[model samples]
Structure formats: structure tokens, C-alpha cells
Target: MAGKQVMLVGVDDSERSFYALQWTLDHFFHSPSASPFKLVVVHAKSIPISAISLGGPGAVDILSLVEKDLKSTAERVTEKTKEACKKKGVEVEVDVTEGDARNVMCDAVEKHHASVLVLGSHGYGVFKRAVLGSVSDYCSHHAHCSVMIVKKPMAKN
Candidate 1:
């Protein structure tokens, strides 16, 4: 069988996401004879300023600024991931989309023909997660392909 066609890694510039990316690269891409896989690191963002200020006098200008900032952040994140991939000798494609993280990730899975989705567990406590809705939780339940959640270890003394 052909190796997994693609693997999508969701990143938010968080430490957990970084660890997840590293773990995925080490476990899958580093292996000899591993299925030739395409790696994609995605940073999904939503700028409310752009969405909510459409009718104001300077709305267009403000929206443009918001988009510029969002794109800049995404580019920075992609660059960081790209550098890491280079250090590990893994080749990957990067994507930055403006939308809900869960939706963006799921869409990328389908758009990129990914066979797996990898993400970091935010490790929010039960109460907080219930109130805020964790992205990993949403992806785990909704993603079309196999999903892996890389969890950060609890701090120790």
C-alpha cells in the first residue's frame, strides 16, 4: 500500500503545537521506507474586526489592516515551522487561512488529501474546556481522517 498521502499539522504558535509538529515529524517522516507523505502546517485565524466593521466609513481600510496583520502572523508561524522542518530534513507545505481553527483544519484535511490530522491538546481542565470548547476536541470528533493529539506533559518540580 502507498504510504499515507498527506499529514496535516495544526499550529497556533503555542508550545504545545511546536511539540506536536516535532513529534509528528520524528515518528512518521523520519522513518526509512515511510510512505512518501506531504506535510502541511496550518495556522487558522479569525479577525473579528474585519468581519464586524463592514459598514463604517473607514471600514474598508480597517479591514485591510486587519487582514494584513493576520496574514503577517500566519506567515511568521509558517516560517518558524519551515525552519524546523529544514532542521529535521522533512519537507512540508504551509498554509494560513482565516477562519475558525476547527473548520480550517477539517477543510485542509479534505483539500490537501491528508490521511491524518495531528494537533496539540490544549490541556484545558474539564470545566474550562466545557465552557470554551477546545479545538483539538472538536477536531478529534469531527475530522474525517485519523487524528492524533499530542499532549504536553504536566510540569514537575
Candidate 2:
């Protein structure tokens, strides 16, 4: 365990995130003479407060439905990611925490004592990027360890 490094990778249902995980596995975990490491897959799920608050008398029902949906989605995505890693013969720890994506990922890195954190950029335009903010960008600066943001390749047409 002395030389084992912990690698934290943020994953979701997005193609970009899946690609990032694949990239990490191919580039690092599958490399010859690669250092010993544990892959920690982190997925953040925020409560659907906005959806609940918008409804009037049916807020409770809306909250329940939204919560269920989000949980199922998160679980499905994490399972899929885990299965893919297993197929590659790489073991990973899956973390699904409820909080802001940026904060949750950063906290995961520190809590797990990861030496490196990897993410995938969504390639959002300026307007959307400014409006929604960038989780990867925020994590890159705020994470306790080194950060890697994998950019998705352009589609060849």
C-alpha cells in the first residue's frame, strides 16, 4: 500500500464522462509498469429543490417523485460505469453523494485522499457555461489534489 495512489474520477450518464473514464483506464490503469492505484468513481446528485419549490400544494409529491427519479438515474449510471470497469478487470469504489457537484467532488477527493482527480469537460458554449457554471473548472482549482480535465474529441463527419 505504500506506493498505491488513489485516483478519483467524476462520472455521470454523460458521454463525456464515460469517455473520460475510458481515457483514464487506457492511459493510466492499463499502462505497462503503471503505479499501484485505486480508482474512486464519484457521482454527485443534488436535491431537486428547484422543482419542489416551484410547485404549490403538490410540492411534497413532486419532491418525492423527483427524488426517486434522480436516485434511480444516479444508481443506474454508477452501476453501468462500475460494470465497464469490472469488464476491464479494474476494481473501483463508487461514491454517490448528495450535494453540489463541484463541492461534492472536491470533498470526495479530500475524504478519499486521492492524489489525482479526473473529469470530463462538457464543451458548453460561452452563454451556457456562464449561466450553468463549470463543475470541472471549479474542481480543478478547488480540489485538494492534481486535476485532469479530459476534453471530448470532435465528431468526424
Candidate 3:
């Protein structure tokens, strides 16, 4: 007998990310064979408060405010992901971390012993991806487990 497999998904407050979450539930979690599995939804907070703090006293106050807002948002997104998964009859654990998305996700894969790491792509072009640095692209290359980059499905007529 084998142990439960873990599936880690990167979540955010984006339509693309929700679509990926749904796709993951439908594609992987729905099957009977996929039992004895655990799903982990993670949101990373990469706030650049260190840079903001370099400005002085006023900047320190602003940095604290920004950090608070970011933490609030991260909690909300994690709750949303948990609710969505619950509705799909899938159980999941949520993790909110402070770091770059790529590194955070990769670390989670290792920490959770994930069998697959799932996330969504924003469908950015080559130039945009180069400039913005795609998290999915980075995780696909770096994750310890197999990776699945789900794209938003187009609406049919």
C-alpha cells in the first residue's frame, strides 16, 4: 500500500488562478484512483517593504501599512481557495507564506512531499513574460515534482 500523495497549487485572486483550481479539482481530485491524496493551496506574499523602509520615518509607517494590507489580502485569497475546494468535495490545506512565488511554491512542494505542483498562467506573451517573470514558468523548471500549468478555458458559443 502507498501513502497519500500531495498536490500543491499556487493560488491568487485572479480569474486565471481560479480556473486553474477548478481544473485541478476536475482533472485530478475527482478521480477515485486519486484517493489517499492531500491538496495544498498556497499564496505567497512578496511585499517589497525592505525597499520602502529605506526612505526614513514616514516611509516606515507606510511600509507597515502596506505589509498589513498585503497580509489581509493573502488571508482572504487563501480562504477563497479553501471554500472553492470544499464545494468541490475536495479537502485542502491552505498556506500563506512570505517570499517570492516561485521559491515559496518550490519549497512547499518539498515540504509537503507533493506528487504534482499545479498553477495557472496569465497567457502573457514572450515580451510580457520576460519583463514580468512568470511564476508558472519558474516553478515548472524548479519544482521537485511534476508540474501542471493550467490555462483559462475559453468560453464556447
Candidate 4:
């Protein structure tokens, strides 16, 4: 990609994600050779499950509480992302949307015309990934742009 292409990184409240973001910044943005990509950080704030119901009078209250918590977590993630970018002296565009991570990221790539979509991998095994559905996997296949999955290094014993 050339002429100030857009590079998007999908982040969550996970260390693996932050590590990937930092790595991208260090390798590409913080390098002496200025990258031609404009960075965009995206966080998918999950919508509260309407299907989750206690079937009691307090069910509404419980749902409201859950929504509030989700909102707070989204805010925290955004703030942390901002701090990370600031520390690197890199300006970025941050977008927070509500939906499944895979869809949100794919949509973001299209929305920004991102040349590359970077995501941190959870490294789930075959069975686990099949059960939980890996966001990175889905994005790699479904996204309109190039997808980069950053795997976290295993800790040395």
C-alpha cells in the first residue's frame, strides 16, 4: 500500500491484542522509515444480549446493569488504546462499534479502505476454535483487505 494507506488493528481487553498493537507500532510506525499507512484502532463493543433474561421483575434491572458494565469496559479499552498510541507519539483514528468482532472488523476494513487488518490471535486449538469461533480466523477469510494475525509468543519456562 502507498500514498498514506490505512492500516487497522482490532483490539480487545486482552494482553495479546495490546502486544500486537505495540508490536505494529514499534515495527512500522516507530521506525526511522516512516510508514505510509495511517493507523486506525478498532474496538467492538458487544451489544447486551436481549436473549439473556432472568424471567423475573428484576430482569430488566439486570440487563441494564450488564449494559452499563459493557459500556464501561469499552471506555476502558479505548482509554488504554489512546495511552498506548500517545506513548509512541503516533496519532491514530479510533472507532468503537457494537456487534460481533468479526463482522465489525470486516466492516471497518471496508469503511476505511484499509490495506491491512491486523488482529491478535488467541491461538485456540482446532476443537476450541470450532466451538468458540476465532475472530481472527473469520476476519482472515471474510475481510475485504489483507489480514494479519499476530500470535502471542508462548512464555519461556
Tell me the TM-score of each prediction against the true structure: 0.84, 0.92, 0.89, 0.94
User: Pairing residues by index, what is the TM-score of model 1?
Assistant: 0.84
- What's the true lDDT of residue 16 in model 3? 95
Quantify all predictions' global Cα lDDT against the true fold: 0.85, 0.88, 0.85, 0.90
Write the residue-wise lDDT of candidate 3 on 1-157 in tens digits: 1578888889877889888988888877786355666788988887765758577668877787788888888878988897888777787789888988889999999898999989998999999999999999999898989999999867899
lDDT of 4 by residue, 1-157 (tens): 3468899999999999999999899888875247788899999999877736468677888888988988898999999999998888888889999999999999999999999999999879999999999999999999999999998899999
RMSD of 2: 1.8
TM-score of 3: 0.89
The candidate 2 region of ten consecutive residues with least summed lDDT is: 28-37
Better of 3 and 4 by lDDT: 4
Local accuracy of candidate 1 as per-residue lDDT tens digits, 8-92:
9999978899999988888887852464677888889766664554896887777788778777878888888999899877778
Winning candidate number (TM-score): 4
How high a TM-score does candidate 4 get? 0.94
Clashes of 2: 0
Runs of candidate 1 exceeding 4 Å displacement? 1-4, 32-36, 49-65
lDDT of 1: 0.85
User: How many clashing residue pairs, candidate 4?
Assistant: 0
For candidate 1, give the lDDT of residue 123: 88
Question: What would the per-residue lDDT of candidate 2 be over residues 27-135, giving only the tens digit for each residue?
Answer: 8878424547888899998779888667578888888899999999898988888888887778888999998999999999989999999999999888998899999
Mind sharing the TM-score for model 2? 0.92
Q: Indicate the residue-level lDDT of 27 in model 1.
A: 85
Model 2, residue 53: C-alpha shift (Å):
1.2
Among residues 3 or more apart in sequence or in different chains, the pairs in candidate 3 whose N, CA or C atoms overlap within 3 Å are none
Candidate 4's error at 32, in angstroms? 8.0
